[model samples]
Target chain A: MKHCLILGAHSDVALAIAHQLAKEGHSLWLAARRFQDLEPIQKDLEIRYGVPVACFAFDAEKPESHQAFVEALPECPDEVYLVFGYLGPHPGSLEHPTDARRIVQVNFAGAVSVLQALALAMQKRGKGAIAGISSVAGERGRKSNFLYGSAKAGLSAYLDGLRNYGYHHGFHVCTVKPGFIRTAMTAGMDLPKPLTASPEQVAKATISGLRKKKGRVYVLPIWRWIMCLIRNIPDSMFRKKQL
Target chain B: MSPFKQSISNWGNYPLTESLVYQGKERPASGPYIARGMGRCYGDSASQAQIWSSRANRCMLDFDSNTGVLTAEAGLTLDEILQTFVPRAWFLPVTPGTKFVSLGGAFASDIHGKNHHGNGCFSDHVLWIDLENAEGEVLRCSREKNQELFELTAGGMGLTGIILRVALQLHPIETAYIKQRSIRCRNLQETLEQILAHQHWTHSVAWIDCLAPGKAMGRSILLLGEHAKANELPEKYQNQALKPHSTQQKNFPFFLPGFALNSFSVKTFNFLYYHKHLPKQKEQLVHYEPFFYPLDAIGHWNRIYGKRGFTQYQFVLPPDQVDGLIKIIETIRAHGMGSFLTVLKLFGPQKENYLRFPKEGFTLAMDFPLSPKLEGFLSQLDALVLKHGGRVYLTKDLRMPPEMLMASYPQAEQFRQKIKEMDSKATFQSLQSQRLDLHL
Candidate 1:
């Protein structure tokens, strides 16, 4: 059976992945900022899948802690799913440089550091998969949510470079571009029901995409067509107003 | 303020059905982000990010029925426009094939209709637009105010800013039906000749079964039309001749089995379709919906391509490259994969937009599945188009190679240069740009 590590185990998507991998007979290492956050997910994975599942503390922003986090794992996980991210609210982030940088650190810099370290480790092992969550919002910079998008854009570009780097060495890096997911993060936000995907739905798509080793995926496929139409919008007309 | 982002994944061709986020109760700090009418626009010409994504901003500015002058919320749809004005004997000054589009989307896309030969793209009829910039400043632009923005925004995809409201001129009509006559052209030569001879007909189009090879290769049935009058309708339906349609729409439930639309089935269907309009004609008043969107009768029509989905391969050949039609027809026939819908239209003069897709040429649009061999086939087709000094239409394209797109749209450099200046931070982007690597 494969050994899969969930880097942000406490997060909904990460726990979901842990549960899925355990069910698929993969051994699990679920890590989060607080070990308690992963306790219930660990219990469920261990009992249901009859496999070893452990929870550990992980602070993505602390580069000093990342190496120890990986080395401290009881078992060497074959694959790592990075589901760590922070959505810095717009107005507040715009006003606070520290808030914006924190979001960027967690989303991009911290992600790149931990992933790259693990990637080198995996590269030595000669085969593994690294899947990171990116957002569709990163596809274009929006005045509404660019703080989150800019970080994602950087992370996405990093993952792309890594994917190319590890391709022939047998490492597979998948970049997930989820459009809109109805999650705790999105709670109370007025998202149109038609456009928002449930977390569970996102989980299923993520797992399926991982299995296929897709370089990129839309949790919901329609964004492909929508963006096609959006991309062609001319600037003369585009400048006229906010859309 | 930064623009709001919208994007797609690289997994498939069309946008997911759910990707459409119609602003339900959203507004921007400046006001509300411009409501994209139909999403047919190619760039950020009409998209205003910060203003559109927020709630608590909504309003319809103004509309005058007598002159068919409509000034409404940037969010108003063509469907809404048609619903309100059709009863008043007013229609869109310019209409694209489908009415499901939004007014802002139409303006952003700068869409043109069958009447493009007589009228130009939507830009021709547009009088003025209200724009909210990155600084929350609302500027009134026309052929005046910010004339450059006006010109670019006409065919520009929402890049400059979000459109808050637009004043567009509408056309006056007695009835929604068009008095149409179908003529069977023996070949390409005949179709071209017929178009030349019937240049005065306000609207005209042809349906060519590209699958039909050799002798029947270019044979097509041309439909010529004029706006019908209320009195012209049959006596039985004349009283309610101008009444809006309340017909029950039909929908396709799911993707049919792939085998259901194979070559054998398509060829037989093509034969039946061709002969159905036989004897060189039928003169009748057909409803506008069916005339423009015959396929719209069936909802979720994309399912016909099966679960794999389909790609619309549309390319334009200059008037002198009529010979390329033969090569194109030959290519499709050689591919042997079945295509259900194929349409041919003659484009008029080019617009002022540097990256305008249509020109004085013959444009053909056909839908086909994403078979393993389709990519290779399209590559060959691209070669032929490039050789003939033609280009593929970006709106309908899903699988074009980046090199082909760059080569085809020589004005790509100029378009990019202008957009870069408008969006200095590079705010506007989409899957198409990422897929083709159009944005740096």
Candidate 2:
């Protein structure tokens, strides 16, 4: 029952965290779209740390499969990570309603559909910790990627409410907001190098936050101050200035 | 999106060129690909267009506890292997000066080490190799199976085929420590004599003072070592004999200033180093990490050679060419191009089936920083070496002309024939392979 379950385990951050956690001697259940895809990661964690690792197939859009994925686990997890995410849009998605909807469906609605069940199971046991990888883009609706940002914003709010719910239910929920990481999702982008955090750094801070039961965490830790400055900006001055 | 393009070079930092480096997580075993490991070679052996980086493919496939035979992906680094296996009383059969190199690179380079006098190159212990030919079909090759392919791929420099995985025979060690003795050789003759006389020693090498003139022409500090048996360890390390090799690795954060590491400073450093051993305190218990890989302790130490980069000229002279070897050393002294690290070692018999760098000979490896006149001087040295039936190590070479390559490798044509048979279209090719016409 003290196992670590990683949903959307194919994400770069999830894989990094899996290495960190498995090194610290935790049994792992990695659930991704294709269990076969996670086979290599599963084998590595199992061999490198001499720990047990299980891989499962679960699509975020296919909500009905979530419960079976959880039940199929060798044991219920005490620590859960919901790292499923998508950053995509059809060309000219700004004007196309379908593309925007798909973005929200994958990021917000899809995550909530699964996390809701996980949060309930943990609430029933009166104990557990769940760390969800949110993003700094959620802090404000950036015009460049607001569709993706809006979904993260909605997910962060849900985490806030869930943390309050877990407060009484004897569980912990951590909202990990990473500013930038060089991951599969962000490859080929000419991102500001100095501001970007590596996947290892994000995993480390998130794990630290989970250990301390911190309600909100920022990767690189500097994003905490940056987001604070952005959040408190007055609408009059903020709207007039480019981010 | 298009592949990531970057100007990457070997660890020497020489001849930097743009490459469409594959940055994906998947291994590029199939399709047109050339396997590029840590790029530790001093030359273009690891550089090519469509460079398939072996970064993501370092999974340990299997390990036979009974025989200590470990099956691992080509991408796995020697450092990673040592970290995992040292505690289990297993060590690599042969490792180059650095642990940063990958298994794939090791197989391709067919590297020899201090133990070459006894064990031979890295491929001697490699039992089988899984190669994806140009047609994208994986073939299991070994000495008993596709014997010729195995031998060709061993020192094939990633030209014959791309290595996907290899099963290596590991040397068992009682402790991660080596019982070592330093024999300080006074000059060129003594250095050769010292290395030659140490046949009883399991591992041996010398650090020569390249600038030392006259009686001190080849003054060197020779090191001979044997893996410490359990009984030989001190009281503190008795129970920890099989513990992992650990060190506090210090790193050079950036390229050192161009003016640093010049002739005078290096000579002074070598002088101080040679005297530090001084016959009195020759014996010591050392962890294999520092003994085998002193440069690895200082990460990115190659950057100290400056942006222009450096070239390493390592040649093996047949036993009868003692006079020729000494002449080569004297010529280097006359040139005054100045060398930084000069190592002298005696190599044993050639054991690999196809292509191998070492035979029964004396090997001299030296590093010289890039200078305008240095290339001309080296070419002259290469000619002298060629006359003596000596050959420069291809892995350490950056600028050997194609003619010199053909003259150096007797098996070059045979290797070419085998490569042509396997990779007719030459899908797997490196900058070095193309330059030397290995795909003929």
Candidate 3:
């Protein structure tokens, strides 16, 4: 059985990943913001899959705690998943400095920090996989959600560079760009059913792609086709849209 | 000399190109190796070796216009043959989607074309293959000498060795247009019955509409065809035309940016395609190019997926898994990501190749433009297929789990045993092999 360490395990997507990996016979360490918040999921995963699983608090927002979390692990996980993000307020992001900083720190700065520390550890071990959940909103800057989108955009680019870096370094990095998912984070927004995907859908895609060691993948593959059409709109035509 | 390694990124854009370097022989040094054909195959069945290597390695060995038999170096291309022999009133006995593929590739892929219902695959017409086994001796494989390898290589994707030359059977035709009959089936069952009932026709293919949910799912357009006789042509063209030919061609220079193929565009295209061939169930004379390869008319067609190439998912369901096929389509529709192009074909009888994929079942091929929902859809489909005793086509699969693949292909152990005994050092390999963990 493979061993999996899920960073930012508090997110609905991270829990789903843990559940799926455990079902596939992978032992798990589901790390999150509050160790207590993970107890229910940890119990459910272990009970349903009959696999060993544990939970630990991992505050990705804190840079100093990153190394200690790794040092305390029972063993280096075969795969490390980075799924933390702060969609922070769109209106507040424009006028408030802290909102913007929080969005950047949580999405790009912290995720990268943890990835670097973990990737170095993985490199020395000679094998491991790093998967990060990025957003399709990062495909291009949008007037409505540029702050969250921009952070994700940076993370996506960073993952690409990491992928190239890991090519011969004995490990792999996969960047996941999901279109729009209906999660607690997206609880209040109005989303089109046809366009939005579920957290389970996103989780399944991310782990399956992880197994394949694919360079990068869009969870719902047709999004590749959908994005293809959207990206081709002439600039003059695109500048006037609300989409 | 050393074996060359080159990274291939895109699919079907560059001219059947591959980098080549010679690895010195270990055993008595067999004959020189030649480039295998198009690589459309699933196994390593058609390979052989040549003493000389160069661009001129390809040669037209023989042609009997009367009986329509042609023999050429395995390196010769289907397009080249079509150009040379089509004008002379002869055409390939069988053809897949595009003509740009090589004869060796066709045999390797053991390709089946629009007429598979009426004709079998390329193996049905393949006369012989010039093979050079591991021992470095040239062995002519047919239904005779080295018959097992010949049968294995017919649909084999050149895994055994190199194919030096091929002898093929060509078909005689009076014109380049086909008298086609188009029928719209309300669903898959009707479509299958129609194809079986019309099996006497020379060609048959169906464009299945996989997006429709529930009662409307699996709707399709069935096309039946036969080469047009001279008298069937329009009077204007028939008066001076001893032979008819295609006169239209279009090209797409580069991959359009991603986001160009959204639901709106795909839905519109599907609607137009469905209605254009609808209600009117009759026959008409049409050019063969559009009939055989409407997609090929546009170049770099795969570029439509943009920089991130897409994978074509094809699977076959045994008779018992018929309901499973419906579920697979429904799952995609439920996910709101219907594939742009999906095809369903019924394969009759089974070939002898132990590793052959089409084993007496109905097969469906769909092009899934990459997306997040894709993984979930494929995973669910993979499990359902495994439960129903179905298998995915390895040639078109890029992300199947090794465990699932092992279970799906009962012959996996046999294939492993063969590879272990024949190529223990693992000299022949590919991205697919690595992805599926099909290597030692």
Residue B411 C-alpha lDDT in model 2: 77
- Candidate 3, A60-79: lDDT as tens digits: 78988888888788877899
What fraction of native interface contacts does model 1 preserve?
A: 0.00
**Among these predicted structures, which one has the highest lDDT?**
2
Residue A72 of model 2: what lDDT? Answer: 69
Q: What is the TM-score of chain A alone in each candidate?
A: 0.91, 0.92, 0.92
- Candidate order by lDDT, highest to lowest? 2, 3, 1
Q: Which ten residues in a row have the lowest lDDT in candidate 1 chain A?
A: A40-49
Candidate 2: C-alpha lDDT: 0.83
Taking the candidates in order, what DockQ does each have? 0.01, 0.39, 0.01
Question: Which ranges in model 3 have alpha carbons more than 4 Å from their true place?
Answer: A1-243, B1-7, B10-56, B134-136, B239-249
lDDT of 3 by residue, B223-263 (tens): 88899887778986575333433435567778867698776
lDDT of 2 at A14: 88
Residue runs of model 2 more than 4 Å from their true location after superposition: A89-92, A95-102, A184-193, A232-243, B23-33, B352-355
Highest TM-score scorer: 2
- Kindly report the root-mean-square deviation of model 3 from the true structure over all alpha carbons: 24.2
Provide the lDDT at A136 for model 3: 83
Which has the higher DockQ value, candidate number 2 or candidate number 3?
A: 2
Q: Each prediction's interface RMSD? A: 22.5, 3.3, 30.2
Docking class of 3: incorrect
